[model samples]
Target chain A: MKRTNEFAVGLAVLLALTVVVAGALWLSETDLNKQQVTAQARFRTVGGLGVGAPVTLRGVKVGRVEAIRLVANEWVETEFSLDRVVELPPKPAVISASASLFGEWSANIISYDPPPTDPNLREALAESDQVGGDAWPGATLPDIGQLTAQASRIAGDVGVVTQRISQAFDSTALKNMQQSVKDLAEISGRLVEFAGAQTTRIDRVSRNVATTSDAFAGVAQTFQGAVARLDTATSDNQLKDILNNGRASSADLRQAAGDLRSVMTAARENQASLIRVVQQADSLMTKIQRGNGTLGMLASDSTLYRETTATVIQFRELLTDIKANPKKYLKISVF
Target chain B: MSPPVASRIAARDGFVAHIGRRSLETARALADVRTWSPLLMGQMRRLGVDSVPIALFIAVFTGIVLSLLSSYIFTGAVPLYFVGALVGKTVMMELGPVLTGMALAGRVGASIAAELGTMKVTEQVDALETLAYDRNAYLVVPRVLAATLMFPVVTALAMGVGITSGWITAVNLLDLSTPEFFKGLKLFYQFKDIWFGLLKSASFGAAVALMGCLRGLDAKSGAQGVGQSTTRAVVLGCEAILVLDAFWALVLL
Candidate 1:
């Protein structure tokens, strides 16, 4: 073989070897020159994260995963290397998530001060922390497939809810709602009409009140004049004398009222007797009307009344005869 | 036994005998590394170093096409950076080794078979045998050893070129930046990916070179046989590559 050929072969082999080794190192982010800080995190799952998976801090590539192992049948502990320059937060936590729709995954180092917005992730972090290790807390974010499945389930639930709503708001419900609206409209119309009537009545009442107010004004004026006159009378000594007389008269009236009250008390006491007497009177009057007694015969018998009238007329005639022939009737005059 | 059964059994025996002979030849050739060691560099220069351009040619286009294709497939379904991932992974894991192997199989396998077959048909191999020369050592060992040693080197170069081509295409043709493409490229990268690919290519190299040598040794019918051996070597080499690729994946990955 020519020396050139051997040289070419050697060069190619050397270059190819370099490429393989260097490519692996570069892609793996195995920086031997720079210092790396090894840290660990425990997760319930790694979500397809494997060795050499990039470890990022706030979306910035900080390091790569070195190893992952299941510890104690409960959690997966991942040991990763971060650039020595990386300044970890006060409470650094790790979240493993599908880097893309593809099966790729990455671990993101974050602060645990503000917990993750996702409830499941927060709970996973809490659980990891509760495991009580020096390892940073870690949680697995759901992959695309899991999220898609959950979305499908949520869509199904929404579809069911929509179907139920459609069923509930059927034609019958629509008609009933329409009827209720119509009744409301009708009631509103009646209320409007009633309000109009009340408005008119109020206007009429206002006019009546205006007239009454005018009449009251006149009455007030007359009352004011009377008050003035009263004021004038109050200032006069004659008014005082009148007041004195009025007081005396009021006292007399009071005494009279007291006497009247005594009479009334006596009358109230004899009320039964008075009622009896009245009843006897009524009976007597009834007897008189029936001509059962002398007074009653006098009151009711025309024959007795005519007989008395005739006796009086005969006496009168006898007196006239005695005057003409006195001896005939005067014989018994002295007895 | 009936005549047909007897003939089938006879054919089976012949086949078994052929396999044994080929196995023996391969074993002897591999064992005679000392004899072939001086010739190894020349063969390496011819088979591995010479084949770099072609392997890289295949890999560049493969990477370019994969980038475009992955971009198309993963357009809205995933982030565009995943185009870098798909290109890197496909090239490193599958296309880089397989394509480089198959290309070298066509180039180097046919070359070996044609050269050796021509020599066999021209009685050069017999002449060597008559001179007490180990034909397997002279003919097979150096070629197989060179191929085995250098196929990985060629594949490694090809993988690098392939990924570089993909990165270029993504940055130029696709809406991707250097960091983004690299981020995706490194995202799913594993050291085992390179190891497995190199291992697979090494197996491919050995198979292709061995098949060519075995076919060349078994050549007949002169010029026609040489052509036939060349064709068969290329065909069988490709088939072996595929089968071995699958085997490695199943076993290693």
Candidate 2:
């Protein structure tokens, strides 16, 4: 090719590329197919909307931003093009989420399941087969920005709470709390004594939890198999639960993870009880070390001590009382 | 003969010289824009309007990929409304501007840099100066003004398209309701967002254009210098856009 021609060809290619991009953009925005079904969504507040922002469902490319209007003081109307085949769930959980942290705003239609529950599987027809515009909302939503922000806010509060808890643990003289700990120790000692006879009950509860864990593990194995099958289904996409397929397996795994986390949290909450149990065990060990009780003496001492100096002290106390008030103490009283 | 006085005097002289040169450049660019408003109309037709298809393809894929990525991790506290909103907000407020600016900078800005660099290496700039013509006004301003004007328009279009692509994914692949999807958009977005988005794009466009023009005008040495200027223009253009985008997002968005 001639030099000028080559340059011209390069420019032409670039130009063609741009034209194609623009045309494709226009088509996507307009939803050039079907042309009907005026897809509209109502917002409590349309923050900084113009007539030409894109409307999306679940972060996918669907249609263009046709227009936005203020219907009333409190309500705003946003109209856009939507491919007719894509069903909109009734009462779908809609939120302002972006595909990118810093990008255009799009509408995510969560769960998009239709009303009148329990559609037969073989009979589950497409919305195009019936009237469009409503379905069941998707699974539990993660509040993207709002959750992160609120989590951050909650984290700050938690930091304060955590510091206060640490301080409560650290607080000494001014707290009037050392006495409380002493009282707690006494109460705990009493509780150990009380539960001493109830070892059988604690054992039973532990056994029950074990049974439940085993049963849960069996169910979990089934879940893992189901997930493995799903992993195959998802294929190279490596879906990994991000897509939220609304399948039972996904729900099971999610719930199981949640349940497991909760169980761990509960265990953490009882950390003090666990520690006390360990401390009580150490005390029992110490008493045995000193040969102070039946177990301790049995472990160390061969003979039991009979009445000795301590017995004489009791006899002396009785005699001293007798001398202090003979009439009352001896009961002679001139009778 | 204290060193402090001499240093102060030199600093003042340098500042004055810098200001004088910059002002002269600015004046030349302004004059160029005035002289070649008509040519710009043609160049834009060839350059700006020409880049449509690839932009659309990119925009669509961007939406899809972003959607795939955005909901990568979900904490079940808040509902998924903001997942959609994240896509919207990022595309509208940040990525749309940044990507569009960078694309234009790489595609359009580098060309301006190379053209100006070549003119300088060959002393065409000096010839123009000798003819009592300001090179900035004749060569730099039209490209700057076109880019400053055209880029934001492209970005807005890209935003519009990106959201559309996101919708397709949401409806078909993600299986979200179209109505609820739009509802999230309606609820979250406002007019200020659009204004801020455009403002950022315009500023970014101007920065990239200016950087490209400056590098081209200031080119030294041979072919290596022209290549260096082009590369520097692209890098500086992108950097300036990003920094300015962040600043504008903070101040305006």
Candidate 3:
């Protein structure tokens, strides 16, 4: 009986010790991070998001996802909790990303710059914990989804703009450009010689401007006196009839004045655009004059110019040969 | 017959003989198990109550040593608590059960074989048969059943002691933070492991008991016969325990 009692006591002691040790361990782990607020963020596609996913703000971990579940409509939602002090910034952008491609996907949050324009909109959004309010036009987020969306939008816009550009520079435009280039080449080939003998041409341009100004002054003076004539003729029958008949001339003068004003307005509106084009043209002309770069060298260098001409001549001959000897060049092999 | 055919015939006969002896051994074990079941309750008390202090010391010291040494070895790679959990699991699930069976077999298997061998030489077994009682029942059932039932309880005791020893060792020798160790062990360990060890222990008990009783029954004539039976009981019992352990590992683990 004594031996049995002793053995039982020993067994009981061991059992109790084990239970106490195991129970204490269990309790410590249970109490760890208890009562923390677990918030879930639902998304259409988590993509690669998983449990134990880190929630980061500007590359700093704010919290971690504890669990993941598929909600209604097969959208995956992540359950996560954050520290008490981690106040979410306004216009928080959540994006799924990875430290590396093969690594786990973490939800990164980036905050917007402080703008007084967005808070009132955000205040309306604060009512629903599920999703925040409307995206402020001034407020922008850089979430991974937003980045992907932006990239796609940019690509689409580029594609559309490219199409528009292609349409704008159509076949007609290309033909016109080719004609213009031919005219320019002819003019440039002669310009060197013309520059050495352009004293007469310079004088002629100034003389034309002078003559046109003179004509305008003469017309203004004539019209001013003509109005006096009309005033006196209004009392006489023949003169009044002539005045009525001469209304076309007065209308023509008014039309000329209107045209001048419209032209001035158009010039004013196009001043900056005209300046930009002029600057680009001037730079191009300067490059041509200095004989720098491809275009300058192409125009000035005789060797390249001869090669190009020869190449075009050869291309013409090749095309002629293909057309003439159709059997040899365009033969279809049965095998 | 040709040499090849003759050898093949001999090999087949040897194989048949091996199969026959193994079948006999299995039949005897089945009979012994049936006897042990009726006397299980009576046997459990004797084995568990008889061996306590040694079981306690060995289990406690073994756990402590494992916990301390493993803490040093695994501290860099894993959390100390996980190490503690591994120690707990290893002790409770395997070491506790197997060690308890070995200890009991050494204590009880040799005794059964030696006692019966001596009684056979002294003609006590014959005398019992003359009184119209079953020798196998009275002699074998009580000791074999006691060892079998005791095996599991002793294992349970060892498992409990081993876990507690690891805790104490983690605190004192490994200098693991008490709370951290507890938390780590808690997170890593499952309750199911303890039950798995208990099951292994019961199986081991049956194996040890059956081997001991069978060897004793097969004892021959003279002092050398007694010695041979004793030696066979231990060697075969230990070997069978290892083989059964491997088989169970494949099946259960």
Specify the highest-TM-score model's number: 1
In TM-score terms, candidate 1 sits at: 0.67
Per-candidate TM equals 0.67, 0.44, 0.44
Residues forming the 10-long window of minimal summed lDDT in candidate 3 chain B: B183-192
Full ranking by lDDT: 1, 3, 2
Better of 1 and 3 by TM-score: 1
Error of 3 at A21 (Å): 13
Q: Tell how far residue B253 is off in model 1, in angstroms.
A: 2.6
lDDT tens digits by residue: candidate 1, A153-229: 99999999999999999999999999999999999999999998799889999999999999999999999999989
- What tens digits encode model 2's per-residue C-alpha lDDT throughout B219-248? 899799999999988998888888997798
Clashes of 2: 86
Residue B33 accuracy (lDDT) in model 3: 55
Better of 2 and 3 by lDDT: 3
In model 2, where do residues sit more than 4 Å from their true spots?
A1-335, B1-20, B27-34, B75-77
- By DockQ: ranked, best first: 1, 3, 2
Q: State the fnat of candidate 2 relative to the true structure.
A: 0.00
Clashes of each: 0, 86, 0
Model-by-model DockQ, in order = 0.56, 0.02, 0.04
Q: How do the residues A1-335 of candidate 2 rate in per-residue lDDT, one tens digit apiece? A: 23443454346445444643553443334344565465565555444333545545666755555666666544455666666766765545333344445334555554434432435211222221232343212111233566688999999999999998887676565466778788899999999898998999989999999999999999999999999988787885657455656576788999999999999999998998999999999999999999888889877865534454567787798788778866776554455
Q: Which candidate is the best by DockQ?
A: 1
